[model samples]
Target: MGVVDEAARLERAGYPVIHLEKGEPGLDTPAPVKQAAIEALLANKTRYSHSSGLPELRQAVCDYYASQYGVRIDPRRVVVNAGSSACLVEIFLALLSPGDEVVLPDPGYPAYPRFITAARGVPVQAGSAVTGYQHTAELVREHLTPRTKAILINFPNNPTGAVADAAQLAAFAELGPIVVSDEVYHGLEADGCHSRSILEFTDNAVVVGSFSKAYAMTGWRLGYLIVPEHMVTAVTRMHEDLFVGTNTFIQWAAITALGDAATIQRQVREELNTRRDCLLAELPRLGLQLAHQPRGAFYVLVRQWANTGTSAQLAADLLKHAHVAITPGSVFGPSGEGNIRFSLSAPADQIVVAMRRVEKFLVEHPALAPR
Candidate 1:
């Protein structure tokens, strides 16, 4: 059984579940972004944009990178799409040949392989928990083959929350294969650490980013990709055909979201850090071992000493018995075996309330805890 089903089924059965299974931001879209969308709608700005997206919105994306990371690029290189998922689809479709191989980290985002398959490319999975789930430059180099066309990296990663090291990222840039960097959670960093954009090291890289995670714009259906000048034609051509363009009002709104992000970004980052600190300190009391303390993103994958069955079964038992929902690690890849991921995306209050129940469950089932 898929790991996430436990949450949905319980919700359907009206089981009074605490949802921590999804990553949708707990906050509403920021006020400025929302106001911009309203203005656009009232101004009749709801038309199919320039077949790539509004030039201004693309420029906004460029301006954001310059201001935040000191990275500079031509706006023409940005291809706006419905979301980062669509950008990934367009990227794989445009870049991957039928027999080409793309190196992906195991226990990585599940959709990486599926999207590669949809593009008729092979996803070569490689990684180990020994590296805290980040795709080490060494592991990536080991996976390289004559057919290797690209390598995918998701920093401030999902599930594992691992950030890339600058040296390793530079090594990846020096590596010959094309690089696809997913920086969807870029601004939502933890502590004082920051995520690296492949663009910082190589202009040959393809960058995927979105307003979803950082700006609480999940339903906005807006994302953009930065491609090298040589790859721009193919990517924009694919975007024109498959996605047409990102939502017009959303494109306009995201422009404001990028400009007015200072306060909200701080609020979100602090809250995530607070939640991360709370969970790391509390979950261990249940005797669940944190294989690694995640430094960024908002998830902690933990393993219990109990023989509670597979990760899926363990997740099911947690939901059924504790009334809490979490994701099973096996769903990501084999390296995720015996682990469960707790998403800190739930509101702080909800996380506190739910962990209390998880603590109670651990107490009742003494077998689930270590001595």
Candidate 2:
């Protein structure tokens, strides 16, 4: 957030900052989704719906899983929220007692720990760097304790774009703790390979999904949680007490988003793939190392050369000197200290331009360049 603010300040001063920092898609919300919201508003469908979400929207979520993953979900178990972040907060609150532990991936999303801590749960780090940033049940088991209530996993993960397979998901399911799978980036795979949902392996899991990344609906604030039947009541109670309900018209729009999800997600995936390829080809030429090839999602975590200083320092220097904004991986976790994350949220041409600037920046600061 500090980097974002600093980038914004530079933009205000007339600097043409190339934004590789934003996690959102560069695309606008699909026309059909926008039109659906407009239609709902015109029809005066502004009244509050169920706190669990509009019945149709929840049904759409169920249908989505059925169609995409061939998994049957009971609509009664879905809870819509303002965003997936809200779902995370509700899940932690419902599942955690004070000091109960939740195992999270180191080098994972920065907000995961904060959400857990906010619910008075301890966030235990399971080192994923050793597994090339892929969180495996084997690594996570080493961190588990009697106090561990859940294992939080994000595939097509943030910062590091590693995707887990079915065997890994099955292993996580058998780990004797609830698996909270963040599948917000499920459909955004850079390769044409679709990601497997944890539900395919076990019903004893919570899925945090959003239309933000795949549908370009970040500003719409629409997301949903799919909980196990046993957890629905407890999670819904927390949602009802805190959020009451999500926006009525927006939920109506989400039904449309899911209805046309195939077409919409394909478009998003293609664009991200183009951007990803550009980075994969160019970043190495710029003397940066990709610790892991991003298979899903829109980020590439690049390792800085030896003696380039902390990831935070490198990120700040790039923003201040190159006018190219990116996230320092350190903010994600301690395991991310020597890396910086590049978000493929800009156009291919813009990304190319950003790389050129980075190349020049490295040349000016020779110590930052790889030997």
Candidate 3:
């Protein structure tokens, strides 16, 4: 966010900056989705609905999973909200007690720990460094302590796009702690890896999803959560107390947005894969090693930098000099210190140009070269 803010300051000062730090899909919301919202607005659907979500939209989400992945989820288990971040907070508040521990990936979404801490829970780090930057059952078991309350996992993960299959899901299910699965990037696979919901392996898992990435609806602020049958009411109550409800028309629009864009989604994913290919191929030539082949999401967390400077310093210098905004991986966690995350959400042409500028910048400042 600091990098984005700094870039914004430069942009406001008339400097042209290419942003590769944003988490969204960076595509315009689909035409049908926009039309749905407009229809809702014209129909005067602005009044607040249930704090959980519109019943139809919740049902649509269930139907989507059933058809897409054969993950048969009860509609009642789905709790719609403002976004996944909001759902994570509510889940944390409802499930965590002071001193309760949540085991999550180090170099994971930085927000996971913050959410746990917000609920007065202890955020325990399970380093993913040796597990190829993914939270395997081995890593989870290694970090398991008596205080463990939940295990948070994000596949097609941020920064590192590594994903786990059903085997990992089953492994997580066997653990006594509740599994918190962030599936926000569920449909954004750059590779052909099929992502299954934790619900497929464990009923005890809390599955989170969002329209922000798959449907290119970030501005819509629509997200949902699927909890075990018994936890729905508590999750709903906490969300109700905190947010009352989310956008009304947006909820109506999301019903249309869900499963409505197979072609658009495929095209977008293909484009992102192309971008990923470009970066993975070219970045290594620049002396940065990709932590792993990014199979999902639109980020490449480049480590083994040419420069001796810290990731934060590299990020800042690039923003200040090249007007290219990338994320310093240190902000993700201690394990992320030696790396920086580059987002591929920009236009293909712009990404090409930004890479060129980055190459030029590094050529002149040879000291920053990766060894």
Ranking by lDDT: 2, 3, 1
Scanning candidate 3 in windows of ten residues, the lowest lDDT window is 259-268
Highest TM-score among the candidates is held by which one?
Answer: 2
Could you give candidate 2's per-residue lDDT for residues 1-371 as a string of tens digits? Answer: 98899999999999999999998978989999999999999999999899899999999999999999999999999999988989899899899999999999989999999999999999998877788877889999999999999999999889898888888889999998999999999999976677999999998899999989999999999888999999877888878888999999999999999999999999999999999999898976887789787899999998877887888888899999999999998998988888899999999999999999998888898866656
Rank the candidate models, highest TM-score first: 2, 3, 1
lDDT of 3: 0.85
Residue 33 Cα positional deviation in candidate 3, in Å, after optimal superposition = 0.2
lDDT of 1 by residue, 252-347 (tens): 998898888777777778888888888887775677788666887778878745677788877877898988888888877888887888888777
For each candidate, what TM-score against the reference? 0.96, 0.98, 0.96
- Of candidate 1, the 10-residue stretch with the lowest lDDT total is 1-10
Error of 1 at 140 (Å): 1.0
Give the distance in Å from residue 348's predicted Cα in candidate 3 to where it truly belongs.
1.6
Point out the higher-scoring one by TM-score: 1 or 2: 2
